[model samples]
Target: MDLIGHVRCFVAVAEERHFGRAAARLGMAQPPLSQRMQRLERELGVRLFDRSSRQVTITRSGALLLEEARALLDRSEEFLACATRIKDGQSGLLRAALPSGLARETVAAILADLHQHHPSVELELEELSTTDQLARLASHDLEVGLIHHPCDVAGLELGPVLRCELGVLLPRASLLAARDEVPLASLTGLGLVLFPRADAPAVYDDLLTTCARNGYTPDSLRHGQGDSFVHGLILSVNAVAFSPPDRGTAAGSPSSEVVWRPLAGAPLAWRYSVAWPHGRKDTAIHAFADAVPRALWNTAAVSTDPPPRPLHLRPASEYWL
Candidate 1:
């Protein structure tokens, strides 16, 4: 019934103490403003003002309700402002996921950046594998995710892709560790410690194919995502794992127990990007996607300069050779 509008008119008239001045302040004609005041008084069954030929005087009821009416208008404005912020994605819950195996620092940076840009968006962040993230995205359980490449992206939209070049992680005592850059073929006899195939089967397969093509084929392949677990495998099982250069520095190996060396020619790299359900992206999703590259670059030294290349699978018939 435009109850708020009536209250606004009443307050203006009470404050101005004249219908013509109140109408001027409200940017409305005096007649309509008078009618609004009349309607409000009729609805409330109370005289809001005493009109005289020279002036208008606010009644006791009108004086008492003036303060309350002002407060109500203020509250209404605040409510609408809050709604606008939510619609703009500046306030609300944003559900997102990241793959496991990222360094803690990298994760922290991502959270910090998002908070800096959108302090009111409560980030419900989770650590999930690419496969699991895709599942959640499809079900509407997740709004955005930082996912590894080469998986199914049939119904998803992707952000800018970054590639982090991989280097060999081996025991310090290994002969290959002494070289500034280790050739992939130099580690022919060592077992490979890799993330579980179930986590990202396509990437896993692509990595193996690249290794084979580069003249290195691990004698055995073992799966582990955790740094400690991969390190343990490297020491106990005579294996090597590939990781970004920053992982070695972050790990801070003592007494030179383990070392990371760049792979000759930088033949292997892990590609990553932010993903969201197709046609479902919003301001929050874009904000999160923008934050990802900055955090990865700051904490993990991931390269965002390279042009994105889609993951191409080798022919199954030729992959085995």
Candidate 2:
């Protein structure tokens, strides 16, 4: 019955104290406004107004309910305003994720940036591998993700691509550490310490293929997930791990007994971008996307340039002719 709307009509007519004047104020004809007031009165089982040919006066009952009616309309307006803010992404809980293997400092910086810009938004962050992120994003369980390249992005909208060049991380005692840069071919006899294939299948395959093409096939592939674990493998197993450049201290340094050196030709690079489900980008998602590049650049020293080639291509296996 649009009871609130009837109350609005009643309030206007009561305050104006004349049917024609109230109708003019409400931008409606006098007949309809009067009819609505009568309906409102019947619905409430109370006579709300005393109407004569020329004048209108509010009944005692109408005066008694007027303040309550005003309060209800005020609350309704407030409710709609709040819903609009949520729809616009100005306030809400945003579920987001980041791939593992990111430096702790990088993650902290990203969180700080998001908070500074979106103080009203509550970001629920998760640490997930690229493979797990893809599955959750597909199922609509995640709202946004920062994902590595060479992964399937079939139904997602991606942000600007950023690249961090990969270097060799080896025991500083190794002979190869003496070189200004290590060529892939130089590490032929060493095992390759890497994350598991399941972490990111396409990236894993691509890394192996590039290494093989460059004449450095590892003696074995060792899997490790944490920095300490991966570093432990490199030191104990006489192997090398590919890593991003660090400032001579954090990523296996003088005290850590490991060192990071650039590749001779920069054969491998990590590319990543913030992504969300197609058609689901909102204000909060955009805020997160906007914060990522700056955070990566400031903390991880990543380059914001677009990669030379596309990140992924659908496998030909799906074709049926």
Candidate 3:
């Protein structure tokens, strides 16, 4: 109730020690300041100043209230300063969701750049499947997403950041292992390890459609949910699977036991894009999104063709054990 008004009047009067001077300091007429002080005293049921013919002095209650009032004012100023920083985008929190398929190195590069350049911006990351990412974005649970493209969600904007060719993972000794690239049709009857079609139907469908457009249906031998598990299956079994080239790192170390080959005739490679609500623009979010591709594009040095066969293949024994 009239706290700001009372605090203003009290501060002015205490500093000036004279009604006329206080009115001038407050840039107001004397009568209104005097009235405001009177109203404040009446509301608090306590007289705050003592008046005499020659001077005005602070009462005991007035001294105590003045101390509290100064503290309140200091706190109010601090609050406003923080609010201004947030409004100006000099500082704030960013909530983002990223797809599990995103490369760890790619994320690390972006985060490192952000940490160095935007010390005031705090970031929080959530790993969500592409479908879940879309849902979270639509519900406003996430501010942005790093996702695979062709997200046709209404009211969502998608901007391509990286276009990665799909590569097949196979045991080094597999028949197709010596090839630099293979057509999807070549894997027609091979055991395929794939992401579970049911859990993330959209990604599964995209993969299937890509294969179908090449005139073949991928034969699924085992289905896993996330990249980790799927990669684990590739390492443990003699199975072959298709994934982005960066996924080679999932093997733990470059391996002689496993190899990756670009998928020839694969209809449109995967495109990773940044997705956000169409009209929700945020500077820090945009900055981070823009930095991602620039950070990742040339860092890995992965080739469109598989690397030349290992000059000296370690004995399979080394990997088997």
Question: How accurate locally, in lDDT, is each candidate?
Answer: 0.85, 0.84, 0.69
TM-score for each of the candidates: 0.85, 0.84, 0.77
Model 3 per-residue lDDT tens digits across residues 182-298: 877877666668655443555456566656667656444587746656656766765678777787655425655667777775454555667788986677677667766665575
lDDT by residue for model 2 (139-229), tens: 9899999988888889999999998888999898999988989999999889988888798888787778778879888888889877888
- Pick by lDDT: 2 or 3, better one: 2
Backbone clash pairs for candidate 1 read none
Q: Taking the tens digit of each residue's C-alpha lDDT, what string does model 1 give over 52-132?
A: 988999998888888999999999889899888778777788899999877788898998998888788888999999999
| Clash count of each predicted structure | 0, 0, 0
Ranking by TM-score: 1, 2, 3
TM-score of candidate 3 on Cα atoms, chains taken together: 0.77
Pairs with backbone N, CA or C atoms under 3 Å apart (clashes), candidate 2? none
Q: Which stretches of candidate 1 lie over 4 Å from their true place?
A: 20-47, 52-55, 250-252, 279-281, 305-308, 311-321
**Model 3 weakest lDDT span, ten residues long:** 312-321
Candidate 3, residue 295: lDDT: 59
Model 3 gets an lDDT of 0.69
TM-score, structure 2 vs. true: 0.84
